[model samples]
Target: MKALLVIASLVASIMMTYAASPSLEKLQEGEKIKVRYTSQGCFHSSNYLMDFSPNKVSIYEFLDKKNKNPTKIGELTLSDGDTAGLDKLFAFYGNGKEKIGCTTVDNISITVIDKDGNTKATYHYNDGSGQAHRLEGVITLGEIVHRLRP
Candidate 1:
């Protein structure tokens, strides 16, 4: 009886661990990641878009809230190093589902999608806090955008 109980506990532990971590390998070719940042105020607002793909990364500055017809401000080809960094970051993120409680004017959203357009993961956070702050300084999409940008 005790032996059976031990086996069951071990199985449960393994399942819990797996459920808490996201697998970077799941990101395949053509995967896309989009990040949107918006600053809202009484007088004016600003918007920015960051896109990451298997081979390219792009950043655009929008002139309106609708994000219509924007100018490409920066772009770069994805390097192996960038992929490695993302893998490390996602590994550190684990389940990647946590509410980042912050208070600031900047609103940020990140979305990851597969080649088939299936959503993989999404993160949303706001507050004047640094972009990487919510990630516990592991890494930030903002940093990736900056690197991709000129």
Candidate 2:
């Protein structure tokens, strides 16, 4: 079956696979900011990068490694209660870096930014690649990354 999704978003000047491009200076609760990422599952299913906003999240799956534009999966509007979770998630974040031990597990990299384009956190879910970098801590983020399931 043919599938399609439409999302209205302001693409940032920086083109990234998993990073939000929003100007956030005076960002208030319920305001429009975004968190973006690409989730890799353990089962090797179809994966995609998503843009998460206060009200909704949109998804696009890559067709191939060389593909630039992706196919839209769909959009999910968040409920009022979702903000609380997002709030907690952002709470664990800060501006800095960390060196985490390598672990062989499925993970996704997520980057969050403040209104001024200041990066609050950059979470890299590595499979023990021996590379070192860090930003924030989020355990339950698996739920958000679950959207990549297909």
lDDT of each: 0.63, 0.47
TM-score to native of every candidate shown: 0.53, 0.44
lDDT of 2 by residue, 1-150 (tens): 123222223233233423432322224444444443343444443445666655676777677887478777777766555545554444333212342444433344565655566666565543333231132332233454454452
- Candidate 2 weakest lDDT stretch, 10 residues: 1-10
Q: In model 1, which regions exceed 4 Å deviation?
A: 1-26, 39-46, 80-105, 131-139, 144-150
Backbone clashes in model 1, listed as residue pairs: 104-127, 104-128
Per-model clash counts, in order, read 2, 3
What's the lDDT of the predicted structure labeled candidate 2?
0.47
Tens digits of per-residue lDDT for model 1, 15-122? 775554333334567888776877665564667887777756787879775679988888877566665665555554444445244343667666878889988667
Candidate with the greatest lDDT versus the true structure: 1
Q: Pick the candidate with the highest TM-score.
A: 1
